[model samples]
Target: MSLFERFEKSFMPNYGTPPVALARGEGSAVWDVDGKRYLDFIGGIAVSSLGHAHPALVEAVSRQVATLAHTSNLFVHEPEILLAEKLLGLLKDPAKIFLANSGTEANEAAYKLALKYGRREGRRYFVAAENGFHGRTIGALSLTGKKAIRDQFGPFPVEVRFVPYGDAEALREEVTGECVAVFLEPTQGEAGVVPPPDGYFQAVREICDSTGALMVADEIQSAIGRTGHWFAHQADGVVPDILTLAKGLGGGLPIGACVGFGEAGTLFAKGDHGSTFGGNPVSCAAALAVLDNVDLEHVQKVAAQLRTGLEAIEHPLLKGVRGRGLWLAAVLTSDVSAAVQKAAADAGFLLNALQPDAVRLAPPLVVTDSEVQSFVDAFPKILTEATP
Candidate 1:
C-alpha cells in the first residue's frame, strides 16, 4: 500500500491525509517521497522559524543530547535557566516563566494562573475575542472563539465571555470588574492572519487596568521574530500581564512558555503547577541557538520584502494582501483559496488556504531572496490556474 494509504488506515482522521508525503527538507525547500522539490511557504504552520535542519539548531540539539537531555521539574538545569533568562531579557520586564511542551500547554499554564488569581481576587468571568485561537487543549480551547471547533467540547471549566475582535468598545464592555482576564492574540493567525487596528492593544490594556483584569496575549504564532518584532504586542507598546509563547521559539523543537509580569508573575506558588518535559535541556539548548542565530534585522528586512512582493502582485483573482512581516495572507477576490493552494502545490510551491478567501504564507525566517522571488514569480500563474 502507498504511504498515504497506510497513514489513512492507521492514523486518526483528526488531520486528514496530507497530499504530499515529504521525505526531507532544507532551507526554504522540501522534497516529497517521489523527489519533487517544492518551496515551502507554510513553514510547518509557522513552527519552523530557522528552517529545516538548520545547522545551528542541529548542532545545539546534538551537543545538548550528547551532554544532557532530560531533567524533570524535580531538578534545575543550566540550559533551562539560561533560556528563561534570555526570554526575560527579550521581554524587558521582571517576569516569571512557566515552561511547557507546546503552545497549547503554554496557554493552559496562563489560563490556570489566571484562574487562580481570579479566585483569590473574587473575579468570576473571563473575556476573549471572537475568532481568536489560543490552542486546542481543554482550558485553552475554552478561550478560543471559533464555535465550530469549540462547540462540540462544551461544558468548559470556566465561564468565558466572547466579544467582537478589534472592537475596543466591545472589549471594554465585556472586560468588566467581574472579569479576571482578557485573552487576545496580538495578530489572529488561525483566523487568516488578521491584525487589529492601531492602538487596539493599548485600548485593551487600558480597559484591563480599569476593570482590574489581567491582559493575556497569546503570541503563539506571532511571537519569536515572526512579525518583525520579538513579540507582536511590543509593536503596540503594550506589555500583557500574562503572555504565552511557542511555535518557532525552539526553532523546530517542541517548547512553550508562559510569562507573567508584575504580580501575575508571583501568583503561582510552588506546587501550583509543574511539567515533566517542559524545560527539557535539549529543547532549551535548541531554543538558545535559535535566539542566537536568528538575526532580527535580517528577519525584518525579509518580512518587508515578502509583504511588498505579495502586495505588488496585480491579478484579477487577487484582491489584496493583509498581515505584517513574514506572516502574511493574500486575500482572494473569490473563495478559491483551496484551489489556489492545490494549484501552487502542483506547481512545486506549497501554500496554505487558511480560509476560503485567505491564502496564508509564513515561510521560514531563513528563506533566501531568490526563494521569495521564485514564489512571487509563480504566484500569478498559481492564481490564474486556480480561478475558475
Candidate 2:
C-alpha cells in the first residue's frame, strides 16, 4: 500500500491504481509488497514467456549487458542479426525484420510500410476488424477497432474500414482496390481472448490475393509459442505478408518486431523509419534465449490439460471458455468478471478481467502442471465467492 501510495503521487492516472505491487517472482509465482505469494497466471499480460526470473533469460541478459548493450541502428550488432535470422528460420520464409521496443512500435513500423505500399499503388484505404486491438499509439490505434479506446483519439491519420470480425464476406466487401492492407489478429487478445471463425485466415488470404492488398497479422499476444505454434496463424496454415510480434518475444524484456515478406520486406528505403534502441543487443539476446528455451510441445500439453479442466467445471457462473492455447477466457453467465478477478487475487491467484464478463488467463509458457491444477481447483470457490 505504501508503494501504491507513492505510485499514486508520482504517476499519472492512465493505469489508475495498480492492485498489486510485486516484490519478486520465480517460475509461476509472485510475491506482493507485503510478502504474500500469488500464482501469476497473468504473466505480465502475456509478456513473461518463461515465467519470472528464468535462469536462461537472466544468464543471457547478464552476459550480453557485460559485453555490448546498444548499437543504435547506425552500426549492426550480432545478436540482432542472429535474432532476426532465427525468427525468419522459424517462419521458414525469407523476409525482413525491423526491431522495436514494444508492440505499438512494431505496429507503427508496419503502419509506415502500409503507407509506403499505398503510395506505390495509389491506394488510400486499410481494412481492420471490429472489436480488435492493435495497440495504444496513434498509428497502431488507427487500425484498432474498439470504439471505447479509439473514439476520442481520432480523426485517425489513416483511412480504415472496420468489418465484423470472422465475417469473411464482409471483409471482402471492405477490401476493394483502394485498400492497401488488411490487419487482423488471429486471436483477439483484448476483446477477451476471442478467436476468429474457422477458415477466417484462409479467407483473408484469398481476399488479399484477389485484391492485391497486403495481409498483416497482428500476432502480438498470440505469437512465440503461446499458442503451441511459433505463430498462431500457423494453426490455419496461412502465411501473412506482414506480421507484428511482441509480448513474449523478449522474455519479459522490451523487444518487438515488424516482419515483412516479399515486396513488403523491401518497402522501406533510406530515411523511411528507424529506432535507436530498437535492436538493443541485451534485449535481442534475451529474446534469443527465449527462442532457445521455449518448449512448444510443453505448451501444447499443458494447454490441453488446462482447457479440459476448465471445460469440466460445473458452475452456473461459468458459461464456457473461449480461445486456444494458454490464451483463454472464462466466459461468465453474468457481468461479474471484475469481482471474480478480485476474488481470485484474494485467493492467491492473478487473473485479468478483460471485459465486464470475460476473465482472461494467460499463464507463462513454462507454467507447471501442478500450478495449473491448483488454479483449477481453486477457481470454483473463487467464482462462488465473487458471484454470491
Candidate 3:
C-alpha cells in the first residue's frame, strides 16, 4: 500500500489525509515520498519561519541537544532565560512569560491569568471577536468564535461575548465593565488572513481600558516578523495586557509563550501554573537562531513583490488580494479555491485554501525573491487551469 493509504489506516481522522507525503525539505522547497519537488508557499502553515533545514536552526538545535535537551520547570536553564529576555526585548516592554508547548497552551495560560485576574474583581464575562481563532484547547477553544469548530465541542467552560470584527462600536458596546478580558487576533489567520480596519485595535484597547478588562492579543501566526513587524499589534501602536505567541517563534520546534505586561504580569503568583517541557533547551536554541537569522527588510520586499504580482493579475477569476507582509490571501471571484489549491500543487507549488474563495499564502521569511516570483508567475496559470 502507498504511504497515504497507510496513513489513512493508522492515523486519526482529525486532519483527514493530506495528498502529499513529504520526505525532506530545504529552504522553500520540499520533496514528497516519491521524490516530487514542490515550492512550499504554506511554510507549514506559517510555522517554519526560517524555512526547512536552515543551517542556523539545525546547528542551534544540534548544539543545544548536545549540551542539554530539556530541564523541567523545577529547574532553571540559561537558554530559557535567554529566550525570555530576548522576547521581552523584542516586545519592548516589561513582562513576565509562561512558556508552553504550542499556541494553544500559551493561550490557555493567558486565559487562566485573565480568569484569575477577573475573579479577583468579580468579573464573569469575556469578549472575543467573531471569526477569531485562538486555539483548540478548552480555555482557548472557549474564546474562539468560529461556530463550525466550537459548536461540536458543546457548552464551553466560560461565558464569552462575541463582537463583529473591525467594528469598533460593536466591540465597545459588547465589552462592558463585567468583562474580564477581550481576546483578539491582530490578523485572523484561519479566517483567511483577515486584517481588521486601521485603528480598530486602538479602539479595542480604549474599550478594554474603559471597561477595566485585560486585552489579550493572539499573535500565533502574525508574530516573529511574519508581518514585517516584531508583532502584528505593533502596527496598531497599542500594547496588549497579555500576548500569546507560537508558530514561528520556535522556527519549527514546538514552543509557545504567554507574556503578561504590567499588573497582568504579576497576576500569576508562584504555584499558579507550570509546564514540564515548555521551554526545552533545544527549542529555545532554535528560536534564538531564527531570531538571529530572519531578515525583516528582505521579508518586506518579498511580501511587496507578492502583493504587486497578485494585484497585477488580469484574470477574470481573480478578484483581489489582501493581508500584510508575507501573510496574504488571494480572493477568487468564484468558489474555486479547492481546485486552485490542487492545480497549484500539481504545478509544483503548495498553498492553502482558507475558504471556498480565499487562497492563503504564508511562505517562509527566508524564501528567496526568485521563489516568490516563480509563485507569482505560476498563480495565474493555476487559476486558469482550475477554472471550470
lDDT of 2 by residue, 91-194 (tens): 88778999999999999999999999998999998999999999999999999999999999999887999999999999998888889999999999998899
lDDT winner = 2
RMSD of each: 0.8, 0.8, 0.8
lDDT of each: 0.93, 0.94, 0.93
> How well does each candidate superpose onto the true structure, as a TM-score?
0.99, 0.99, 0.99
Task: Identify the runs in model 1 with alpha carbons over 4 angstroms from their true place.
Answer: none
lDDT of 1 by residue, 1-388 (tens): 9999999999999999998899999988999999999999999999899989898899999999999999899998999999999999999989999999999999999999999999999999899999999988899999999999999999898899999999999887778788989999999999999999999999999999998999999999999899989999999999999999998899889999999999999998889999999999999998999888887888888888877888888999999999988899999999999999999999999999999999999999889888888899889999999998
Instruction: Output the lDDT of residue 152, model 2.
Output: 98
lDDT of 1 at 78: 98
The 10-residue segment with the lowest total lDDT in model 2: 1-10
Model 3 lDDT at residue 232: 93
Model 3 lDDT per residue over 304-382, tens place: 9989988999998899998999999999999999999999999999989899999999999999889989999998899
Candidate 1 lDDT at 325 equals 84
Q: List the residue pairs that clash in candidate 3.
A: none
